[model samples]
Target: MARSVRWVTGAKTQWTIHGEQLVDENRHIRLSTADVELPDGTRFTQYVARMPRCAMTLVFNDQQQVLLMYRHRFIIDQWVWELPGGYVDGVEDIAAAAAREVEEETGWRPRSMEHLATFQPAIGSVDQPQQVYLARGADRTDTAPDVNEAEKLDWFTLPEAATMIERGEIVGAATVVAVYRALTLAP
Candidate 1:
């Protein structure tokens, strides 16, 4: 048996989709144009992008520091600090993906991972769901991080991480959410 939760419904504001035409597709994303009708009877075609789900983690150590990756995003052409994460492979469990990303990208195996939150980075035009996890601690392995993953891996105190966010040095949406979540949980 499943429990049902009621939502505030606004039928008049609901938009209807007539059809979606595929623009292009790849293993990473599917692009399409949707024929949509708005509540006021206005119709239009809108570009939509469907991407694979992603998983990220905030891995904390005993010293109250969180592991982070300093890397360059060619798309944005900026070097930033981010939580370890990657796209979840087909049919792979999200939690497992988060753990694998942490170890593969930072050489740190999280002791345990608890789901912190799930969100859409771009709700208007992109369907990319991101899951954020929290790990209290991790152990460093002899394995080195993937060469292309990051320029460096380091730990920052929660305050330092917050400062980075304020400075716009930590810009990924998932990283920002996880850092703020971890800050509230920190003692």
Candidate 2:
């Protein structure tokens, strides 16, 4: 047997999609435009971006330090702190994909993994869902990250990580959410 939970919000608004077009298609992403009617009877065509769901790993070591990557993102033109994560490969399980990304990016594998949360990283424009995992007892391995990946790896205590986020050092939404959850959520 299963239990169902109903959620409610004070306000109600509905949107109806008349039609949608796949304006652009590629191996990694698909861009589309949808003609939609709002609850207020206003209608318009809006562009949307669709991408494969990805996973993020918040690997914490025995010392309670979380693993992170420091890299320069050209789009942002700044070096930012991020977690080990990437897009899910073809037909791969979300947890498995997170483990793979962690190993490939940080040369470490988690001895135990737990699903933390999932969300649409860019809910307003992109339909890219992200699943986050809390990885414990991570051990270093011989595997190396891709050459195009992070410039360096480091671990930070929970407080340090939280401070980094507060100071805007952690710019990525996925990383921010995972780190915040890691700090606040119970085991």
Candidate 3:
């Protein structure tokens, strides 16, 4: 029988965490193991990961096309299309980080960034909070994009982006969410 904890009160279906111990931690992520008890008295240990918040932008042009980066994610070992983004630096404003990532990764400076949504990419095991922004316009900067960030930058219509997502070409959660949001705003 699972002993009821004082912290959980209302919902009988709610899983309660009895204890958690840190496994490893670094600048990117903190990993931990948690002892959890289910509603039916089942108990198990589960791995949990927490990561720094990330900000990404969906930059658009007058043509209603979105700016995207063609990059290789070494972890996935595949080249895919993604929105410009990165982990928010310590104490940095998330919108500012979104704009900065746009300029750094694509050499395009966003005219303005408006918060679209904040979401968790993998709610099951990873606690990575991501912020998505909508930029209706941008200007090409004199500086070149960081070579390490992306191999190329291009613009695609929202419908095209949706197709790409369906085809497994656009895989990043933030990018997919931004595209759907932009599609909702499209004429």
For each candidate in turn, give its C-alpha RMSD to the true structure in angstroms.
6.5, 6.5, 5.2
Q: In order, what lDDT does every prediction score?
A: 0.94, 0.90, 0.93
The residue-by-residue lDDT of candidate 3 on 31-70, one tens digit each, is: 9999999988999999999999999999989898999999
Candidate 3 to native Cα RMSD, angstroms: 5.2
Question: Which candidate number has the best lDDT?
Answer: 1
TM-score of each: 0.92, 0.90, 0.91
Regions of model 1 farther than 4 Å from truth: 1-12
Highest TM-score: give the candidate number: 1
* Local lDDT at 142 for model 1: 92
Q: Candidate 3: deviation at residue 181, Å?
A: 1.7
What is the full ranking by lDDT, best candidate first? 1, 3, 2
- Regions of candidate 2 where Cα sits further than 4 Å from its true position: 1-12
Q: Better model by lDDT, 2 or 3?
A: 3
| Candidate 3 structure, TM-score to reference | 0.91
